[model samples]
Target chain A: MKQIVFQHHPGNVSSIVRGILNRLVIISFLFGSLASISFAQAENEVLSIKSPWIREAPPGIPTLAAYMEITNITESPISIIGVSSSIAKMTELHEVKLENEVMKMRKMADITLNSGQTLELKAGGSHVMLMGVQESFKQGAEIEIIFELKDLPAVKVMVPVKKDS
Target chain B: MNSILLKTLTIILGLIALGFGFWLAINQQRNTGPLISEEVGIVYPQAREIGDFQLVDFDGQPIDQQRFKDKWWLVYFGFTFCPDACPMALNDMKKIKVLFDEKIAQQVDFAFISVDPARDTPDRLKQYVQYFDPDFLAATGEMSDLQELATRVGVVFVVPENPENQNYVVDHSTFMLLWNPQVNLQAIFKAPHKPEDVVKGVKKIIAAF
Candidate 1:
């Protein structure tokens, strides 16, 4: 009887151990699925650049304007501090402003990129002012512009120089 | 008697040739005068003189009548947001610059004054001007002041109501004002003015001064 009782006790202990192992496996599986979902959500919030282009400068002129659209997918705000191009001696962020009655243009320190927002840098508005051009910007030519973003890896974009429409 | 007759005929022939030469010279003189005079057409009304006003350039520098003195200024008034006409006009101005002789260009100046000062700050004006010609200067000031100057130059500028509604457009005159060294508004050329006309007008005006 004692031998049979000991065997039953050992069986119960084994069953309890097996039950805890099963519960742990289920908990681990749930955690893995939740982690993947969070990662997918984070990946979907990447910012994108669009419609990047540059204006053709007149002959012998060393300055030009570059325009683009910045689309933010994140739920937080971002900002563009500046840009650089190998083809230009200097690149700056600029905005067209109206002081009093005159239309004026000046360099901007930074451009805000709001969450899930799109900002356009177009002619006669905000634009990237490229100065001291190293080479002539021919029509239909593709040039590379590297945009520096706040707290993110810089984005390299190819912008076409086109005739003013 | 035969010798005397021959001599008289020769004399008559000489007189006829001389008379023809005289007539040709008189006609040439009359025609040449008008040709030269017509070359100097009446100065366009808007180009007559520069009005007194204070404005700031793209660099936030103050520009007034004094800025135009001692240099030949080619001034045009337009906004940055103009899609077609303004850019076309500026391109023509650029062509005019290319057409100018290098020595003459050194003494010449170009500017684009903003008619829509409400949106065109000095900084925005600068970028637009620089895009066309790096050497070009842009200026803007109070709307009332610009209106006053535009009125004097016969330019029409009307700001649309509700400009903040995102579809606002400004209607303004399209004229290029040419000022001479004496700071006088020497002449005004209407829009769609040819680059050749600008070159010719500028050369003539510069030659006169």
Candidate 2:
């Protein structure tokens, strides 16, 4: 009996060692892929939005507005074609300019933000105009606005609805 | 001969400009007061009279100059579709209202008159103005009436020619007119209205009156 056990021990031990080595290789590969994915995400975080907020409007109102401070940390300039949100039927870049004592609302096709610059979307100035709002945006409700860049990935910003103070 | 005529014309134009500058300086001095502390707004030498306009209030009641009788009014012309300037100006007016004491608040009222009457119905105006403050008043009327009232108050607005173009914007004055209790135009508060300036202006005008 001792002679038989010694003869099979070498084969059994080698098989078990091979199985453990295979699992180690697979785990390292998985960790490598995850690290690269996180690195890519860190690289893509060049556009940052701060203090995003939506101005709550009354029920049955046709249009509402959103304001934010958008900063571009990249070395290249970016052009924002437009904005879209699920809460509105349509979205537009609207500018309220006081030209010669006349307040005029004009549709802006695109907004260009230079590299390392910030654009302030504020009330009584350039703002994101959501038209044909489908639902009422009460105070403290959260909404999502998607900004379409000219050639880059869309930036999604979650904004909270707030009443003007 | 042409050169001599040109020189004479230039001298006459220069004299006219100088005279105009002199008149403006004197007018500025006359209008200055504690109420008109900063040069951010315009205080007319004399309060101007506005022409009569027939309109319907947010409650569907007929409103004219008579409806706004015996109370100071800070009137702004904007439509409900206005996404920026109207809301901002109204917010400023709201802040100004909050800054005033009860006595002054009682003597003052806020009005938002819509130039885009084609879309700003009584119901819409009611929702729009009352959104800012329940006490806020709003009205809309025929384009002719709006135009006449705007001109009398030294403001103007132009809407789209086609009534079907619902997406069109109405280009209107950003100035807020200060009306005396008698319903006459008292002063003009320019755009980018600061609440402190507006409050000071209103107090001064009321105290002077």
Candidate 3:
């Protein structure tokens, strides 16, 4: 019935009105997509990674450690649930705890970073453990890792492989 | 009267000997202060001796306690698969060596003993430790031998009962043990050791001995 009324309408005003309505719909769709793209970028920027590097281990070694300083740039706190990388068969967040003088490596559930707080994943501390490394990462090589954040999009970083000085 | 005088002379000589012995002990105590004073590290008044163990070095050569003789050693126990604690300890060992003078550095050496012998082979240990420092001595032995060595040194370690899983992590003591030239444990630098404390503690222990 609405289509019939529009087709039978006598005035040119209705056609112009329809044209304007169609243009408005298209414009709104475009703006919606653009807003989502910017939102995704903002999510990626929530955690800032500084001086990200992977410790270059000896050849044929099956395990490696990646260290970095991660700061929450947003006003809200962010939590990292896990990490992944193509450089190894498995990637996990691990921490070295000295219990009764014994060094025990424990898996972490989530790493929480409050607003404006920096969390250091360093040696003899928390680190991203890459196990079953397929190939030896030589010095100056770059490896890509993805940090999975809770309730947010994952952040990807390119970490350089360097010998511990 | 002659007998009485002879007895008195013997008693006087005995008293003089006792006084000399007491004086000598006091002088020794004053000369040797403490093995390690204050917050450096833990140093036992008497050095503990380590038992014999059959282990292989990075070069695939069999090594026993004799390998530790004639040089000061900063010994660390861990595995090659351990990324965080193990490598950091090895790096600290390197830094401790740098803190020593060239002459003292010559007399001092570092040892990386892997408790996870099932995974860390002799060849792999060589590359792992030498990657940090070329002069690092790496070794691993059977689990029983390693356990015995750990017991002697007052440290403990637990290897995976079934290490077939390639991702198994071994738990081991992280403290750096300072061994004298006689292969005896003289001091222990606890975990998160600073290179300066290790150097200072070693020097103090070496001087005392």
Go through the candidates in order and give each one's DockQ: 0.03, 0.54, 0.53
Q: Indicate the docking level reached by candidate 1.
A: incorrect
The 0-to-1 C-alpha lDDT of every candidate, in the order given, reads 0.73, 0.84, 0.85
Best by TM-score: 2
Model 3's alpha-carbon lDDT is 0.85
Docking quality of model 2: it rates as: medium
**What interface RMSD do all candidates show, one decimal each?**
9.3, 1.3, 1.1
Question: What's the lDDT for residue A146 in model 3?
Answer: 96
- The C-alpha stretches of model 1 lying farther than 4 A from their native spots are A1-161, B1-47
Tens-digit lDDT string for candidate 3 (B100-155): 98778888999999998778888899888888889999998878888899999988
In model 3, the runs with Cα more than 4 Å from the true position are: A1-36, A75-77, A112-118, B1-39
Best by DockQ: 2
Alpha-carbon RMSD to native, per candidate: 16.0, 11.3, 10.8
In lDDT terms, how accurate is model 2? 0.84
Tell me the deviation in Å of residue A19 in model 3: 14
Report the lDDT tens digits of candidate 2 across residue range B1-209. Answer: 99999999999999999999999999897776345744557876688988577988998888889988899999999888777788889999999999998889999999999998778889989988888889999998888888888889989788989744455678998988899878889899988899998897788778887
Candidate 3 accuracy as TM-score: 0.79
